[model samples]
Target chain A: MTITLQEVLPTYFEESRRHQSEIWGKQLTFNKGEYIKIVAPSGSGKSSLTHFLYGLRNEYNGKLLYNGQDLHGYSVEDFARYRKDHVSIVFQDLRLFPEQSVRDNLELKRQLNPYHGPEKITEMAERLGIGSKLSVKSRICSYGEQQRVAIIRALLQPFDFLLLDEPFSHLDDNNSKKAMELMLEEAAARGAGILFADLERIDFFPWQRLYHL
Target chain B: MALSFQPIKPLLQTGTNAASRWFSYIGLGIGVLLLLCSIQMYINIQQLLGGDSPRKDGHDFISISKTITDETMGQLEKNLFTEADIKDLEGKPFVSGVSPLLANNFRFQLSGGSLVPFVTDFFVESLDDTFIDTVPPTFHWQEGDEVVPIIIASDFLEIYNVFAPSYGLPQISESTATNLGLQLICYYPDGNRATFRGRVVALSDRINSIIVPKTFLNWANQRFATTKELRASRLYVKTKDANSPDFLNYLTEKHYKVNKDKTKFGRVKQVLQGIFSGLGIFGLLVVILALMLFSFYLQLMIARSKDNLQLLLMLGYSPNWLSTNVARRFIPVYILVVLFAVAATQLMQWAFHHFAMYDREELTTWLHWSVFATAGFLIALSLFTNYRMVKRLLYRMA
Candidate 1:
């Protein structure tokens, strides 16, 4: 059950980056029923690469073959539709609206990319132990709480691949391990790939493959 | 320790920090002031345009005899007699009557005091019994009441200095008051003496006046008949159609001089109205200008605070999203400013009214709406300017 890149790329790519200069030499593929992790330092180009793959950066001058269809074949709008429908990102900084409550923040994301009913939010909140803190302001919450909120927000969306940028950097060892396990379990249930990057070397959870950039 | 080489984030926030704070204060101040001005202007315009309210409709038109010995009348004839002027006069709809007369302000002295009438008296062959009877001292009396004793203001009272040695200083107490019930003696050069006694029915203390009946006044004048003079120093006419063009045309064609009289009570009212309207409009203009200045300052402040906006962009939020977020935060500030302006204007108007300062009605109406409207306008303008500034700054940063 190999997940073809063409099948996943159109879900995230409004504009295909098959002919991007940066991804010209990189092999692009998504395998179903498997999780792939990309680890990189803070300043490394991992974020850039993710953007390139997601069709956010259109100036790449390389061949990115998503199941033999060049990434450049799609337009910018096509890539946005793909991102909206299939790709989700748990930002390193969490990218939460500080003015809004934690629950409202999650609600906004769910509305923007609702894969399931509101029941999914409850499930995610319970899994993250953020059920009680839903109405709290995101700014007032602990780093670990914010991290889980970010992850839950991304997990609630229906996507083939989840981009996690230092998703568990703020969590303690116990919470980090538990959050990572839950994330992997949720990804597996959805049959989605969890791609994450962090400054520290984290290795408690199991992964099918890891790449250092 | 090797410092990892990292590229700086491309987004940069621009502008000064104090811009918003400065603008906020300035904008609010201006908004409030302008709002007051607008209120005043509105009231002035209402008065000028003649609202249906009784006070607003108070005699704004003047009927002057064109034949008047006055600089004002002369100016009017010279500047306002063109065919175009006639059309303008017709359109303005002020009925004018003409009479060739010189208006004189006379200080009539009597035994008790001097009286300066607001409306000067010119002899009519037959004194309108109804009109004179309706006049005060007469109004104080009732039918079947005892023969109303009318007091006469003597030359002594008229010349009674406010700082006279005998009076020390004039006061409202009885010691300073002239004996209203007492009458000593009256005399003439003919050596005949008459005892005239009358109870003081009314005394206008402000003007130090003791008014008597026209009959007594005429009888007293017989001794001073040599000083009798006939000069039409005043031309008096009242008309329901005072603002009509035909009346003005009739006066003009008759070659009688007409001047709008400000000294007369009726004409003075019109003058006051004109002055009030002018002041109100001027005040409104000043307030509006102040509000605009404040709005400009407010935009500058908001532009400065946009540094956080760049950070949002790095999080993949677009320019439109950032603008919406900024606007949301700023809207509350403007609403607060508007509320403050309204409250402040009301307070100021109330203060003025309490002190009997400037015209209360005009001032109140101007302040109430002007402040709030100015505040609203400033907020909107500030937001618009802030939007453009943010857009331009972001484009540069991008």
Candidate 2:
């Protein structure tokens, strides 16, 4: 499966901002099982592209196609099916139910489309060094701990592509490297691709092509 | 990964007032009870009145006559019913039999035993045998018969008993009156006199008249030849449904008068039924108001959890699944409330049958099938309404 962006420009951007951006008017495609990096400056719609690909934001000028069908036209049931099986996303805001524990947050998504057993939640938590914090509420957790929790919540499902918007923003270098290794290993096991958008280049991630936004 | 509503449950229940919802449940319970009780009371009243068993000893006989207004008062013949008028009444759907009341045309006087000698001028009439409540074998007369058997109205007998002492006369029992012999004298236009022996045979609750055999009255009217002719002024109408609104309204429209006592009681029954139906409608209004109140709580809950719901949707939680779970939470509650109403109705009916009605065969202790059908209808209605509301609220948030 491949996602194609056709001369896409956000509705909120100024005309001068569109001319200076490389991805605003260009047609680009990202294939399955391939790692692609987009280096976007501040206020450059890096999060907007992630939201648009996840079928969340529609305030854009041009079409986004997933497997040749317009992503904007996907019905609710179609989105549920594709989001369960085709694509997954982790927002930069780390949208976790604050009152719920780490185990509950992971179980919620896994229950929707279960590709793993109940034990996989504990296994993934332990591997990310948050297994002892499983019973703790996500709200009281530190920023770095919440970001890792969100990463596991997104990876609990089967997908052809995972959209990460500055996933390592709150993590230190060592933790960021650990979380990145887990994401890439999980992505490689299922032949799924990763579209990682961040403000700067990370030397650890092996990318096939780098687009400047 | 068990299917659990644990995560979304707390999110949905926030910001909702519990007391308001409890008040709604009470209102809903009262509404359902009123509706069911109204139906049961209707059936109970129907049993008490003539609605349950249509026949009482015999068919219902309604006495009808044209209203005697001032313009037609002195004109006796004009006020009497014509044959066409009788035919029109007989053709009505509610009427099964019609008999014109025949009266003795000649002047008549009856004198009973000589002790107090109950003597007075009296009028004699005859109606069809079918409409009479009680008919003895001896209540028959033929041409040239010296003995005449009569049927007297029981109400008239009671009235005479009440007033008999004032006139220095004795009050007679029903059996005594039946045995007492009497003299019936008739005078022709030329003042020639003829006499016959009269005896009472039966007392009737059906008609209020001094009833003789049709053969005797017709023959006497022809022999006496006192006035121009004898015209029937009233009729005995046999009907299946004496309390039918259509039949009564028809009589009113045509200026036909019926016995006031029977219709007075019928009017009372109608008023009671109207009250029950009105109360039922009022209860339904309360139920609807409660449902709307509960919907406000639902809106508050969803509105409070609007961000959580949007995030859940963002995580690929289908709106259909979320709505189903939300509605499922309340469907059982509605069913239990309706069942509570049904149980209350059943208890009331049992008490009515056991205490008020003395365990009569007229009413059943349990609820009627129609009551359960109403309960079922209410459940389905609540289900549809809840499902629709949840769907609309979720879709709006989306």
C-alpha TM-scores of all predictions: 0.42, 0.78
lDDT (tens digit, per residue) of candidate 2 on B39-108: 8898777667655212445556778888889887889777798988888988999888899998888888
Q: Tens digit of lDDT per residue, candidate 1, span B1-398?
A: 21111111112222454565556455555545554544554454444333221111233223233354456555644523344433433443343322212211222222323221112222211122222212353423332344335432343344544434464534333333434443423345454554444454433321113444545544445543334542332233333343333454566675545443322333433455557556656655554565455445545544544544443443334455445554455567666766666667666556655565455454343354444565677567756766766565554443
Query: lDDT, candidate 2, residue B364?
Result: 78
Itemize residue pairs with steric clashes in candidate 2.
none
Model 2's CAPRI class is: acceptable
True contacts kept of each: 0.00, 0.47
Taken in order, the candidates have interface RMSDs of 12.2, 1.5
Candidate 1 error regions (>4 Å) = A1-47, A61-85, A90-158, A164-184, A193-213, B1-23, B41-258, B262-322, B357-398
Model 2 ranges with Cα > 4 A deviation: A13-29, B52-59, B67-72, B75-240, B244-255
Best prediction by TM-score: 2
Cα lDDT, all candidates? 0.51, 0.85
Comparing chain B with the reference, what is the TM-score for each candidate? 0.40, 0.75
True-vs-predicted CA distance for residue B74, candidate 2, Å: 4.0
RMSD of 2: 5.3
